[model samples]
Target: MIQVEGLTKRYGERTAINKLTFHADKGEIVGFLGPNGAGKTTTMRILTGYMPPSEGKASVAGFDLLTQSLEVRKRVGYLPENVPLYPEMSVVQYLDFMAELRQVPNRNERVDEVMEVVHIADRAESFVSNLSKGLRQRVGLAQALLHKPEVLILDEPMEGLDPQQQIEVKRLLREVGAAQTVMLSTHILAHAQELCDRVIIINGGQIVAEDTPDRLSAQIAGGRRLQLEVDGDGDGLLAELRALPGLSSVRVVADGRFEIETAPGPDVRPLIASTVVGGGWKLLELRRERLSLEEIFIQLTREEAEAAAAAETGAPLAEGQAPGSDSAAG
Candidate 1:
């Protein structure tokens, strides 16, 4: 329900978001995963018609984001990073006001329905000023969904909440994604992996990687990691493991735990096991693990940053090398 093409937003000479082109389909939950200042909020604002892009065009729910801005706003539910709330107003009052603004049918009942939908009904009588950050987020979400828009765009929806609150919000988001287009921006890769049906990783104001979590994980893993939990201190083993042939790198994660990376090819478990056994160390745990979503995110962003730097340095990346890699292995 969202289509963006070459969307560019510039602040004077600095580009906030550059040439971003992606879409979120109906009944899909797409996440924009990036670090701070990676242009996620800028892109969201442009899409929601809160701001204009310096270049390119976008549409939301079949309405042009530029020309048909009002219609786009009508179909989009936006929960910005800092939700604008009236501290003096109660939850119900604030939602009632928003409902009136949207001319919602059955405004009162719809307000209550959305409050329940976001699990903020118990605080209906409480003033918005009295609510916690999580509660405030719920209120903002309630107002956004007060009119049941076609698309939901949330920026950093789970920033300050405790684990329990995060779970509650995640559940609510999953339920909402069942019918509407849900697009959220977050720096948390784990959250994106758990929540998004499709993830688009952004960095340096550009698209880094976009794919399903599983596919991205498998593709960008580059090399597989083997986790080892030694019975005793693995500090000294770090050097020996790093010197091992066919291994990318080895580091002691904890006093007794070590993580080893190996290029994707032959299975090296037997050789690693023998080496550890020969060292007279008790191997408590040894298993090959796929790269986590967080690792993939870091790799993609790092590569993008490196590539951007290389471009500025008048040097192009090598063949088969990652976007910004200085070498094939880089």
Candidate 2:
């Protein structure tokens, strides 16, 4: 329900996002993953019709964002990272005001329904200034849902919530995703892992990766790793496993667990298990250990930085120098 192509935004000589191109399908929940200042907010603002891009085109819900911005806004619900709330207005007043702006029929009834949906009914009379961060977040959500838009663009929806509150909000988002296209923006990998059908990872204002989480794990990591443990001679098992064909390096991690790497291919767990058993060792654990989403994110960022450096300097980044790290002399 959203499409962007070569969407570039600039302020003077600094580019916020460059040639960003991606799409979110109807009824699909896509996570927008990026670190701070990585142009996530810039892309979101353009998509929500909050600002116009310096160049390129975008469409939301099949309406051109530039020419048909009003139509696009009517079909989109936006909940920014910092929600714009009228502190002087009560929750009910704020929502009622938003509903009227949307020209929603039965405005009061719809306002109450959305308040209840976001579990903020009891706070109807409470001033927005008096609500807790979590409550204010719910109030923001209620306003976004007041018009029942087809697309939902949420930035940091899980922020300012306790664990229990996070769970409740996640449930609500899942239910909403059942009928609406959701573009969730957050740097929290765990949240995206739990809530997104697909994740689009961005770094340096460009898309670094986009795919299902499991597929990304397989594609980016280049191989699957195994975390194995045996209640016996750690050195002997490590030595023996290293000798096995098709296996790569093995290193002992915390708690005496052995982390082994192998090229992406057939299962090797059965073979490892048999070797441990044959040596009279008790197998405690043997399981696939793919790269965590956070690690994957770091790797992508590093790659992007390396690519950019290569393009500019015709050389790889210096060893031990992290992406975006300062040089010795600045």
Candidate 3:
């Protein structure tokens, strides 16, 4: 478990993180999302006791992050963006050394168990320099889990891997997260959508959006979209659909096909169907359109940036409202 309140960090006059607030419960996987230089790593460092926050308070696994740092450190497993490893040391030797550093009881048994858990048993004899990138990432993860810490903080766990390696790492994370608290920072929205039960989107050193994937999707919802294919009169169909009540926008794609968007909270499909059928137009297809994870992420972040800009210009804006972000439909 982790709790952070008004967590602020600064480098001289520049605030890398400003009054961030959130908490992750035990046995939950929470995704930390932001663009490059968004203070994600700074927050993680403060949480792991690697650095101190300039203001505010934090606790990890019931221990004060500042006052009880050692206890907090002992209960947290951290895998930084670049893993620290000895190139000449074999996998088993490296893990043994980490186990000793962690003061793990019965270091040998712990090393063996971590190797098995990370599926690096076969590479126990392989030197760190000899392993592939995927294997090296696995070794880094193994070291993080070597101490059996209560919480896992992984920074860009999927960054530099091929597709297959990404899948492997995702599976490993899902397995490890079953019983431990996981806080993962990533730029990939699809990864978060697939892996996290809840997501916290950060921008300009502030919390912009926080919710489940479905709920986030619903924020831009209620706009009825339809892909319609007909046997003839595509232009006429587009014009007719645009004129129909509740229909806002219409686009003709190919021969006798159109994409349509209805007004918020209105279902225009019945009108389109009845009109097409009554006018002797044969309807070949019809379906509602959906927004992708990337689209949703972009929309939310763009709004946050615009809102921050407006605040700096002395323009008053509603709290938690981002420019270009539609909070009306969903």
lDDT of each: 0.84, 0.84, 0.81
lDDT tens per residue, model 1, 61-93: 999988999998888999999788999999999
What is the Cα-based TM-score of model 1?
0.82
Candidate 1: stretches off by over 4 Å: 228-245, 249-259, 264-286, 312-330
Q: Model 2 over residues 167-197: C-alpha lDDT tens digits? A: 9999999999989999988888988888899
Clashes per model (N, Cα, C within 3 A): 1, 0, 0
**Local accuracy of candidate 3 as per-residue lDDT tens digits, 1-330:** 899999999999999999999999888889998897888999999999999999999999999999999999999999988676899999999999988989999999989998887788999999999988778888999999988889999988888888888887888888878889999999998899888878888876777778776666655443545677788765566667767887878888888888787666545666788888777788777665556556767876777677666775432222332123222221
Distance from true location, Cα of 91 in model 1, Å: 1.1
Q: TM-scores, in order shown?
A: 0.82, 0.86, 0.87
Model 3 clash pairs? Answer: none
Q: Tell how far residue 13 is off in model 3, in angstroms.
A: 1.7
